[model samples]
Target: MQIAIRADSSKIIGTGHIMRCMTLAHALKNEGYFVTFYSRAHEGNLNNWLANQGMDVRIIPAGSNSIDQYSTAHGSWLGATQAEDIQATLNIINTVPDLWIVDHYGLDHVWHKAMATRSQVMVIDDLADRRYDACLLLDQNLGRKESDYAQLTNAKILAGVDYTLLRPEFIEQRQKASIRQGIKNIVISMGGVDLQNVSGIAFRTLLNSHLHELESITVVLGHANPHRADMQLLASQATHIQVEVVQGVSNMAEYFARADLCIGAAGATSWERCAVGLPTVLVQLAANQQIAAQQLTKVGAALSLDIGQLESHLEPVVKELANNSDKLMGMSRLAFSLIDAEGTTRVVKEIKSLFA
Candidate 1:
């Protein structure tokens, strides 16, 4: 069977959608199914990266006009109107796929319905705010339930963290992961784009906190992060605390295993941190992240800090976690209990059943 994945990554759209799609695509490909990606050429887009990964990639040209005309809240992130996007996608695809996976917030039921004529539709979504026209719908947020999408669609729903599309590396890392004891090592990952440079703020907050036991702080930056140079320069100037800036990391699970604590954006990485039992201080980088951050904090799996509160609240929170070993151990235990590292397998089994 052939699969077509519709997802995008840009300065505004971020890379979480496409990254998770890649995880699913790889699983399908490994199971002897052909997979192709359909993405637009937005600024900081990962079209080329997807192509380099040995999958067939089809690129849609970004529109020349302003993005204000589209109606969806995130319509501007699509770089074109829904009609135009559908037309462009139709023009490029030579054959109808057995399954079309849609993973863009800017697109909803309207686009899905139009493409349904060509193939069966599957949607991978985080926000349950819109309706969908799909045979399968997957939302991997922590507290999500099928009732959340009751009014939206009748698609077979895969809700909650059990369906999170994590890479195979996380499973391997989980085997090596042990309970964290102290806050000697820290990791700051603010997502792939980090347009606002939150990693720098977190790094600066740690440096000024003057935690004498800190041996090293590792800051992970993506290939598309605009502030990579600025972060590298800042890391170079640090005298007291050793800060390492790593970009385009393929082995993030290793970093999670080595770190005692993580300061990260509350997006898809929330599940990754939980898989490795890494206690985190989550910052809500986008409005979509608000729910996950709140739920994680509520469940005692992690801590939360608003982006606006990072400067004021981050240092104090880190200090408290550093001084209390019991809290750190408790957080790790709770986090480890949430994920089983078999999400990809479970999702793939369902997709294969569609053919059986």
Candidate 2:
């Protein structure tokens, strides 16, 4: 089988979608499938990273006006323009693609509907803001609903945390990790793209709080972070907290494995935390994150905190949680029950069944 993925990774786009797709591509390759990626030549693009993984990458040059328009619409660093990307795909695929997987937030029904003509398309999305015209739709958020996309035409829904395509390593070590009461080892992973310098704000809050139970503070940043130097500099000067800023960690399972608790944005990492049974204090870094933040909290896997309320509310909450080890342990156990680390394997198995 030949699978073509339409995904992008850049400083602004944050590499989450591309990273997840790479996980899928690796699984498919192991099952004897050929995979290729079509991406734009954006600055900080992960074409090299994809190529390093042994996948062929096709880079399309962005049209001048289209790039400007898309950047203005999304943000300047959103990898590539949707119009230029779609046109580039048409020029390459003369025959119908066996399968086309798209992972982009800016792309809406218009883009997916147009691409549906050339292949059986599967869309990976977190936001249900737009309709899709694809054979399969995957949203790996904690409490995604199938009915959220009822307006779409003939799309098979694969919604919820179970469909989260995490790597096999995370699943393998899920059970061995202890979900017990202990001093809080906090993890701060804002997003691959922490545009607002949230880590600094969070760190400040932690510092202002007079709690002493913070055993460790691990901050995970992407190598592509624009503020990497600044974050590193800040970590160096931190006095009260034992801070470590790690960039481009391949083994996230280990970090999540070691943490007694996490303070992270509500995104793809939420599912990874759930898989490892880590009690997490979820924060919505963006407007799109609110739904998942609430859903995960409602499901008893996480505690949701809005970014708007951080200054006034976060310090107190963290200080209180640190003293309540029993509550933290219960949250971890509930999180473990919410997701199995074997989610990627199950998702791949379903894809194979679709092929059959």
Q: Which candidate is the best by lDDT?
A: 1
The weakest ten consecutive residues by lDDT in model 2 span 70-79
Which residue window of length 10 is worst by lDDT in model 1?
63-72
239-325 per-residue lDDT for model 1 (tens digits): 988789998898989999889999999999999999999999999999889888999999998999878898899878888888999
Whose TM-score is greatest here? 1
User: Which portions of model 2 miss their true places by more than 4 Å?
Assistant: 65-83, 92-96, 239-241
- What is the number of backbone collisions in each predicted candidate, taken in the order shown? 0, 0
Q: Estimate every model's Cα lDDT from 0 to 1.
A: 0.90, 0.76
Compared with the true structure, what per-residue lDDT tens digits does model 2 show for residues 1-356? Answer: 88888887766677777888988999988999788887767667778877887888877665443453423334343334656667777787645568888887766566777776756788888777756778888887776789887886468888887888888888777867888477557778887777777876776676566767776788887656667787788788888778888887888888998988788888778888888898888888766678878887887778877777777787777766677778878888998888876667877786776689
As for candidate 1, its clashing pairs are none
lDDT score for residue 54 of model 1: 81
**Candidate 1 residue runs with Cα over 4 Å from true position:** 64-70
